[model samples]
Target: MNKKVAIIGGGIVGASAAYYLSTLPGGDQINVTLYDDGVGQATSAAAGIISPWLSKRRNQQWYQLAKDGATTLMTLARRANLSTDVYHQTGTIVTRTNEKDLHDLYVLAQERREDAPDMGEIKQLDEQQVKQRMPFLTRSQPGIFISGGARVDGAALVEKLLAQAQQVNLIVKRERVKLDDHGKVITSMGPQRFDQVIIAAGPWINELLKPMGINVDVRPQKGQLLELSIPDFPNQENMPVMMPEGERDIIPFGQGKLIVGATHDDEGQFDLSITPEATQDLMTSAQAFVDSLSADNIIRSKVGTRAYTSDFAPFFGRLQSHPHLLVASGLGASGLTTGPLIGRLLAGTLIYGGTPDWSNYEKPLSTYLS
Candidate 1:
């Protein structure tokens, strides 16, 4: 018998899960329908950074998840025939303002390189080398360059996934879904019964599960970002992503275009308005690294709300209270890097029912329910 599966949410996590579920082995036997209300989608707002080595977090679980996520993105890029402009392996330059900070970054880089050999050519760049490689950077601070670091276009990736999913007979509906107690999915068109439902809503998962008396510890993390265009900057496309050991990053988007951003604010609201304070802060931080982006060069600012968990880890697996419901969310800032893997993990569990090794991922809400 064919199992009818309904996926709530259309962000990266949900989209990736839907794509994998509709194409994985034995997936053809499953009928999939994806419901997206098109509200609070963090995937499109994501910075799409894929540099796991730059993170100083030494937790094995987090590291493994990020590593697998990066690997999965590469595999998907190739499999999906995504253009190079959309996904760039442009590498990353991790910099620090002071000598002590630079030294600390070097030590962490050494440790990370030794632990993950596949990171590929983790080396320190002198001030001159940094300038030569990334001329847009104004400061002469020492930086660490990782060859494998890359960036992605989150919005483009989602579109590709949706197209592929539809190609494989997965139904895409832009409707808000409500789940009744009996596992009936309520949509605008009508109520539909599904054998299973997966909640991949980024920050709105809590609202969807509230009727079921389930509250996953997900908070809205507002990240305000800036998009800039540095016109006539020589060889800007080849310049790598620059990080200043802060909450901000400068990502190059080819053709002298740059994305400087992300002010982390936890106001717990869906307000997409950019605060003047955040814009100034981001611009000030970005200017310290890249001199060209003056006040006048500012293109525009945008906002994205990420699903942040209490433990700062993603939730994956079936909810024990509701056996037919599975969830994957709370990816925080690492969603672009880890969302794909989370989807694959959930899809694998659904396709093959057995004791699976989920040690590397986050604990599901079921762990707390019991």
Candidate 2:
């Protein structure tokens, strides 16, 4: 008999899992059912930019995972015959407005050792050099570092991956999941049994799995983002720029529109209301880097919550008590950058009998449940 796998959540993480699961050896013998309440409306939708360099400081293991994830997405796009326009290869520019933060950035750049292959040497850019590379930047800051990175349209990537998974016979279900006493998964729309279950649900995973004795300390970190439709706003040269103010990032996605974002609030709230204060804060911080960004040019704005782990790292690997259950959550703000690699690791461990060294990756479930 073939083994069946039930995946909860249809966002990037879950969708990536289904995609990779279909590619493994004897993968055709496995059946994958992906469950989601709202199709990519959570952290996946809120992902502004995907960059390996920005996430490099997290640690070497995470950096490798993120890099692999990005590479996998690019490979998938080519194989699927999809347009590569969704992924912008323009590198990011990390600018410093405050001297203190500038010093810290230099220290971080210096501390990167030779063994870290992913974090290549950070190249310092002068005002003219920065403008030469990314003319959209106003160059109001004194110091800027150009790091090799890439950006992806998070929403588009999710849709593309989901569509590709469907092509491979992966069942996609749009419904919430509930687990039984024996740790069996129960979906709101359908009743199905599986040999294995993976919970890649973002912010709602904790609540959905609590009754099954799987208490994930994942909290919702809300982020508010805005899009601008200024036609004259700089073109493709507009690279991803991060400002010291509120640690906001200004990302350009090719066209006249730009993605200005992200306020991190630990209140664990799920309301998508765009507050006046957040809107003003985003506009103020955005203007610091991109001088042309004004409130009047704003086309759309919304809020979304990302799932944050206690250690700020993702939760991967199988559950100790319930060996059949696996998890890949707590991606926080790096879901788009890390989802593919983590999904590959999770699927490899579960279906292929491979072992994943979770020493660097957060294993909160093992620590608490074991």
Candidate 3:
């Protein structure tokens, strides 16, 4: 008996779920139909930094989720045979505006390493060492280095996931979908029924589940990014991601492509327009570090809507009232870090029928949905 599964939102989570369902053992028994509107999807404009160990946030649950998510990402990269251009362990360099805060961060990373050693070597680098490691960096600040950190191209990764999933009869429709109270997926083509439905629609989850008389604690957050290309730059493809003391972090990709400034605009709503203000702000901040953010070097700008909760904790699992319905959102800025694991967990639970570990979460599903 083939189980028909319909996944709404073809971003990170949905694509990942489809990828695992198509590649894992016994995956042949499940069929997947994914719907993606492709407007303001957060993953498309993500800041793709996977160095969660250096975060100063006190939420242990979120920290664990992010840590595990980084692990899951590598596993999928290997299984899907993703190219170096899409994913790479370039490590991460974090800087602080205050020296004491930077030292505290180092101590925190060291302590965390005792329990979770996968963060790799943790060390401090002087200004000279920082510039030596990343020569393009002009304004070198004291920084800490984490060897296991990685970077990814979010859009490229999703494309690869969908491409691989399609090989196993995965149906992809570039349309929006809704859910009725009776448990059917409402599409423009017509009403469709599925044994299971997973909604990973980022900030748009409320709209998709509205007709079902259910609501989740999710809101839109617009993230703006600036992209630039430096032709013939030295080892630009291999430079580690940089996290300065602000919203703007520099991420380098293959072929001298550099990304900067992922602004967290909580009031920006679902608007996807790339504004000059954002572009200028990103470029100005980046200019302090690199040689140029000039008009000639500018490639483009991207904006995407992210999901967030009031307390900023993400929740996932089968609905208490509707067990066949699964939902995950409220990832906020950590979407790129946590989305893949949530997708893998959703697929595993749907197939293997086990309770996801909720001991780490303070409120679990009740925090976002009851």
Q: Model 1 over residues 1-370: C-alpha lDDT tens digits?
A: 8888999988888888888987789898888999986766788876667888768775668778988788888787887788866677788888876878777877887787776665677778888998888776677567888887888878788888888988875899988888776656888877888888888988887877777877678788888888877764776776778776764888888776788877778883577787888889888888877776677887887777888777787778887677888887788889888988888888888888665768765554554333
- For model 1 the local lDDT of residue 306 reads 88
Clashes of 2: 0
Q: Please name the candidate that would achieve the greatest lDDT relative to the true structure.
A: 3
Shift in Å, residue 198, candidate 1: 1.3
- Give the residue spans of candidate 3 off by over 4 A: none
153 Cα displacement, candidate 3 (Å): 0.5
Per-residue lDDT over 1-370 for candidate 3, one digit per residue giving the tens place of the 0 to 100 score: 7999999998899999898888778789999999997989999777588888877788888888888898888788888899877888888999876889888989988988887676889888878888887877778888899988888888999999999999995999999877787768999988998999988998898887777778778889988998888664677777788887764888887677889868888878898888777788888878888765587888888899999999888888888788888888998888778989889888888887767776574356866863
User: What shift in Å separates residue 29 of candidate 1 from its native position after superposition?
Assistant: 1.7
Q: What is the C-alpha RMSD, rounded to one decimal, of candidate 1?
A: 2.0
Measured against the true structure, the TM-scores of the candidates, in listed sequence, are 0.93, 0.86, 0.96
Better of 2 and 3 by lDDT: 3
Name the 10 consecutive residues with the lowest summed lDDT in model 1.
361-370
**Candidate 1 accuracy as lDDT:** 0.79
